[model samples]
Target: MKRIPIAAAALILVALGLGLLDLGLLDLGTPDRERFRGMVSPRLQSDKSSDTAPTIQAAGPTYVGRQTCLECHRENHRLHSHHGHATTFRSTKDPEVARRFAGKSYDAGEPFGTYTYHVDDQGLFVRIPDKFGDRPFRLEYALGHRSMTLISLLPDLQSDQDTPRSDRDTVALEHRVSWMASEGQLGKTPGQHDGPPQTAAELFGHRHEGRIMHRCVYCHVTTGEIVGQQIVGLTPNVNCEKCHGSASEHVRQARTMKTPPPFSVGRVDWDAESELQLCGDCHRMPRDITRKQLREYPDLLARFQPVGLLRSECFVQSGGSLKCTTCHNPHQSIDETTETEHEQNCIACHDETTPSTETSRKHTVCPVSPTTGCIACHMPALKLDGLGDGFHDHWIRVRDDK
Candidate 1:
């Protein structure tokens, strides 16, 4: 018998590993349920005022803050507080802050040093042993939902309650260790552990300055003006205005005039491609990634739903009908959405009764496990390394073999 080449053997091993990971045979570590339960639920109300509106609004529409939206949409506002997007970014000042960092320490080992966390009257702080700096770095922002919280040491700026800060390019650090909701302890942050630290900031966590820093805050916040390198007049977390676009005019017209003028709220049309672009802004889309990357390591891209979904046959042949909202409710937390509901969404498009064929019908039916296991069979959860849990592959297709 001929022996397989070294590279070929390596490839085979990798494929086997990926298959096992997809099946969740490997123990990446389960989230600490008690710790996850400790997360502070997002606040229902925002201190809405003209001054609190996003200084720099998106090009098309102006933001009016989620508070103004509550006047009209009370129910949606209530449900949105439970969503991961609503708690994506927050200051450490409040008791509702996601995780308490006090009395936590982890030894990263080797080139990376030990990281220690503590809370004081001022706020939470991290101490990283490094040649350049050994002082406790104040963690001003917590970025993530219940699954994980990344600690960010932001650039120092003078406080002026009345005026917005002038934007300027500055350095910031994302701590190497993140508060893992699963483990309930500090762990190596995803996407930060593999490569050698190129800069001092990277030693702790990925460095952010200028555009990078603004990008970090942009997705987490509902709306904010990017002034040079700073985000001013910011509203933290995803809210009604995040999806519905700026409703300042809509609110104004409704209040002042008996009949509100026909203000076209963004996402009303909600076309497949347009919705892909909107959701992809943060979830990541095909355009945001390269073709080579997607083709070479499709499993890694599973974390990004839009990227995978865009490549799926369903989105391609659905004739502009398919959208992220097709299966997902933007206002509700994903945890609330059940597997049964997702399977029903599959059944809605493809007839389970008939055999899949190249017929006049737009979609082919599943031959095996028709009504049930639609999501498991087609969009099997693929566990990406470092993400801790399996994310259902949005690239919907037949996967008979593991």
Candidate 2:
């Protein structure tokens, strides 16, 4: 064996060392390798950064209300006002509430007996007459604006006290009778399908305190602060800060500088999972509801678009491209007349190009006309029995059975 050249021998040694390193049998500890490792595995750095991030201190920024936001974002405020979310929770003073209860009386015969819904200068009153005698409950809030059905919210009798206003709890009790806009009539409220009270005594004693303020008010209202059963501060509308988080810091920044710092609350810089969770908080994602609850309350699923969309094969395959904001502008009311626009969103992933017969790999084509609207078939409008409104299912799937 002839002795190899020094240069050749050096090259062989380097290659052998690299091979051993690749096989994890040797450690080079090179700066380049360390940099590559840092780039690929950033969780270690992220964990450290997150650990040191400033947490919410005691008595943070206070809610300034939607009017403060409207001063700067007039156009956005105007558009959001038309959204159903903005009008979901309202005081009895709202004109829509008056329209709903105007001369409307639901005569719930038998055990419940006759119940009259009346709106006057004193506000909404539900006069219930049974074997126990006539008792009128004051309705304080309305739970919906544009939906076919609107749930009435009465003042919580349990929470009613002669204590100081600051000490008193402002709570809402759900009324059994709900206004149905579609049929232009009053019927049993959603989830109360058991057909009123069983007996006359039960009707009189029924105190359906669903805890509307604590249980569901947070979603409907913006910056709702509940402290020990009492609602301290609440802006009864889905305002600018609701999705964007508390705008107190942003407002402070804006006041001092001509060009304020970028508002960090609910920033678009969030990761896909973070973005999903943000919307999922209110939209009722899969994590929010159990399989048993979903099966039992199938009608409730119609309202939970995020839950349905997350379950869709399209959403799974899209790998984070598809989101609520993909088709909807959160600041504005959803445009129902955007059939062509909606079809374009579907076409973004599902190209209309015909597959070649010779090609081994082929994409799934729309069984119906590819050029036409895809949503009509894939995400058909499903009528919710509870609300009596047709909600387009966000779950994008082939519905050949339909």
Candidate 3:
């Protein structure tokens, strides 16, 4: 028998390793935090602000004082309010703020028909039906954290009652306005992690969990410090350094009135990839590309969500490589620049058709000519809470056919 060449043998070995379950070589199992000394070069970034370390705070954890950066960055703080990260999770004071869904369920047949949720000074919780006829909804206080939102399953699909003890993630965020108003099904049980538990999420495969993990910090919190003792902060709040790097040099430059790389505000010309990489570092649709597709150190799993794997169906061998940030802007809203929130992600390439597809994929394509806008095609408006927001289905599809 002829022996395989060395390169071919090495390729086979790597492929076999990658395909294995929980390979120690790939992610080392945990995706949250990597041991710094193990991977990061020891060229210590000596520019840590303040020769003395931070003094711990009494509130809980010692915050790195977002005000410190705000001293030099008044404008940066102004822009934070518009982004999703700013008030993504706000704690409101007025009781009327909770009145939107006062008695919640008007009818039991209305999907989550029997659950009533209201918010008072205590925060958000729920009241469930004692019987099918129990007022169709019962009054209850919002438990856990008041501002905290959760997804729960309706009676029929509750995983805590149905699924085995061995699983989770087979769940939904309950008590949100989506549950009562949704014409579509909603809610989930906590222990039914058979594949993906939520019907909607399963249909879309899975969202990269890395977003729930550490990387969410770049977008969510205004500040983060990964000390040996603890990890802390909340999401949907963009802190200071999202635009500025590390804040050490920017802090130093503040003393001398020098400008930092990020806040420089100089006009520079570059391709979409060059520009988007700054924000795409955290925002890209992470798909795990295999060794065959990527040439660089694909081993860096925490930072790069394998966009290729997440939206593989969108790609055909015939089409060119579509990097996501090609259409989406990371730094500022394209709408702010052009007065359009949803950029034309679909039309920039193809005007796809649908009428001929199955019941699920069927679309009413015009007989004379077929045309669908990117907003309708991708970020179809999803009505959650009483508000209607254009939830761009992160599924990132070319058409309903995919």
Cα RMSD of predicted structure 1: 13.3
Better candidate by TM-score, 1 or 2: 1
The superposed Cα distance between candidate 1 and the true structure at residue 67, in angstroms, equals 2.1
- Residue 85 alpha-carbon offset, candidate 3, angstroms: 2.3
Cα lDDT over the full model 1 = 0.61
Task: Tell me the lDDT of candidate 3.
Answer: 0.34
Give candidate 2 regions above 4 Å deviation.
Answer: 1-59, 130-132, 148-172, 193-213, 225-230, 265-269, 293-300, 335-337, 352-367
Q: Give the least accurate 10-residue stretch of model 1, judged by summed lDDT.
A: 36-45
Pairs that collide in candidate 2 are none
TM-score of model 1 (CA atoms): 0.73
Q: Roughly what TM-score does model 3 have, to 2 decimal places? A: 0.42
lDDT to native, each model: 0.61, 0.56, 0.34
Model 3, backbone clash pairs (residues 3+ apart or across chains), number: 29
**Order of all candidates by TM-score, from best down to worst?**
1, 2, 3
lDDT: the better of candidates 1 and 3: 1
> Deviation in angstroms for 269 in model 1?
5.7
Per-residue alpha-carbon lDDT of candidate 1 for residues 15-57, written as tens digits (9 for 90 to 100): 1111222332221232222221111111101213334764333
**Cα misplacement distance, residue 121 of candidate 2 (Å):** 2.9
Q: What is the TM-score of each candidate against the true structure?
A: 0.73, 0.71, 0.42
